[model samples]
Target: LHAYAQVVGAMPRAFAEAHPKWWHVSLKVTDHGLTTDPMPLLDGGTASIVMDLAGGTISVRTAGETTATIPMTDGLSARVVGERLSAALGELGLAGDIDTDRFANDDERPFDAGAAASFWDVARLVASTFEEHLSGLSGDVGIVQLWPHGFDLSFEWFGTRVETHEENGETTDHPAQLNLGFYPGGQAYFYSNPWPFDADALLGVALPHGAQWHTEGWEGSILRYEELAGDPDGPAKLAEYARAVFEAASPTLMA
Candidate 1:
């Protein structure tokens, strides 16, 4: 799934309008799976890449009603699949550079249709929960998206505060923000990390559902997925955790 996402992400990165926040490259959750939305083609048409997790295939479709599909089969290497996608785009007249380095794995991958379907179910639920949380917030909020780089689902709420950074003799100002994300990787977990994190103000604050302030490798609050699994009130508990982090850290972020 991660490999497929990387290839899908490369489409927008290579052809879509470059969003300053790179929102264009992030995949949006669809009813069946994830989509790259639409990328305008040089020929005045548009193209999109769709990962049909439910059907276990990656499809490339063009506005001209052309489509090419690559099956998600066991033992297909990421490189092979990427090559197929690139070739498909070429055949569709929307050829462009697909960063092969981003998915430079030659090892065969096992595809479990049942597991993929289950993941899609969980992704839909989590995306809905994230959106519900975002609706109550006032200010600039990003849409829930899945980042292919880390294969994490997340969104950000921007604060009024501006943070300044200097790099290579250039100075830039960026808005402070808080991210609520779910990482489905090893030991899956959810996190709410505030930019320019104020350790003094945020640490020691209580978080619900066994969530804790993690300051070891990174700074933020995290709640393991296991904490909510099988619980009847899992969604509610996740919401509470998100709200607690916001209430605890928003003040410092705005300050």
Candidate 2:
């Protein structure tokens, strides 16, 4: 709800004074320290400004359908961001349209115009599918497959290429991702590259079941693995953290 709050708090009295009769604002906060439905603040007419910091997004909406969405990062503080937002609005000329009924007539620093809350409920909804989106390239030659193992693990296969099997013990043929396979596994598996055995040095050969490797990063490095495994929650945790960062950077918009 931080986004809505920023817009509400920074709203220019001229805007509120212009539409005081029909326009309003409100906010809905949850226990998880997230905000949603910032429009409610305006609809309720109780508060002119509302902030929604949920689902990895910061959004502020006015009765005129004018909205400000900002991406969030964990490294930044809310107060500093608020000040920056106020200045940005002033520059954009939107600040003058902010509702003023709920704000003091002489409020100069828009950041301190009203109260704020964490919109946790809204956060949960957006963070739901983050873990499912862990797919990317590892290196030029090898194939990187992400599995939900003990930890987030990626297996890179050089030489021949990696393969998969079905329940009937028959090998299945599928196009390799970028000439490599990028399979998304569980959290633990993704966190730590875990497999049945060590498959390094065995290029073009698919090791037996439960064999994978974990990748730390890419620095022109080439390491092979026969098999590997790790913590399960790794991928989910990483996804959640990333979503949180994105949410802080900006607000969500309905395209």
Candidate 3:
């Protein structure tokens, strides 16, 4: 929970740097284990943006009582989403900091593999909603990586089709696949140790090609994964990726 709070603290500052046009970003948090119903954070009773970390998944919802939620599985993926939040702040141009006091954590529940499963489900749920919102945007939008819990769903936008692939084969269902990102489970283990945050030996799960870490990029119709073995500066590259994803996805967010 302390680690999550630290990341939460950085979100507002990062968003302020991205798109500094909007006034405020909404914030929210929900957990299945909360003994009492949680309250939404509001400035003047109008819901802005929310960050929900409960049932093992962490999600970010736009202003108003979130009618939509997407689930994210990877802890590292949250860092990417944080980048988007930063970018959204820049777009709003509010010239102030986001109120992140709404972030909630379930301390009663020990962080474990099963708890992590719940977290991934929540992430996929929220990611699906994010895809829907971005698809409807009038401007160009790019989805770099859909890191569902464990597996990485790679995608590229081509006209109306969303090109994607995994270890199995190729898929073109953008919305459907986004929804399916939460399906696979049972393989992930709760990582108690601090995430490597770099290319140092990846501790969670191995990629299909046995690479330690992989990143996704969209170029025309191709979704590319540049896999690296191990580098002393791998952690730095991971940080860069986190910032980029956040900036790219921030436009659609209310925050």
State every prediction's TM-score relative to the real structure: 0.96, 0.23, 0.24
lDDT leader? 1
**Against the unseen true structure, what C-alpha lDDT does each candidate score?**
0.88, 0.31, 0.32
Q: Rank the candidates by TM-score, best first.
A: 1, 3, 2
Instruction: Give stretches of model 1 more than 4 Å off.
Output: 63-66
Best by TM-score: 1
Q: Which ten residues in a row have the lowest lDDT in candidate 1?
A: 89-98
Compared with the true structure, what per-residue lDDT tens digits does model 1 show for residues 153-254?
Answer: 999999999999999999999999999999998899999999988999988788898999999999889999999988889999999999999999888778
Candidate 2 residue-wise lDDT at 204: 31
Give the higher-lDDT candidate: 1 or 2.
Answer: 1
Candidate 3 C-alpha error for residue 127, in Å: 29
Model 3 per-residue lDDT tens digits across residues 50-152: 3344444333334444432333334443344445544443444423454433333322323465655565454444344445544653433445232212233
RMSD of each: 1.4, 19.4, 17.4
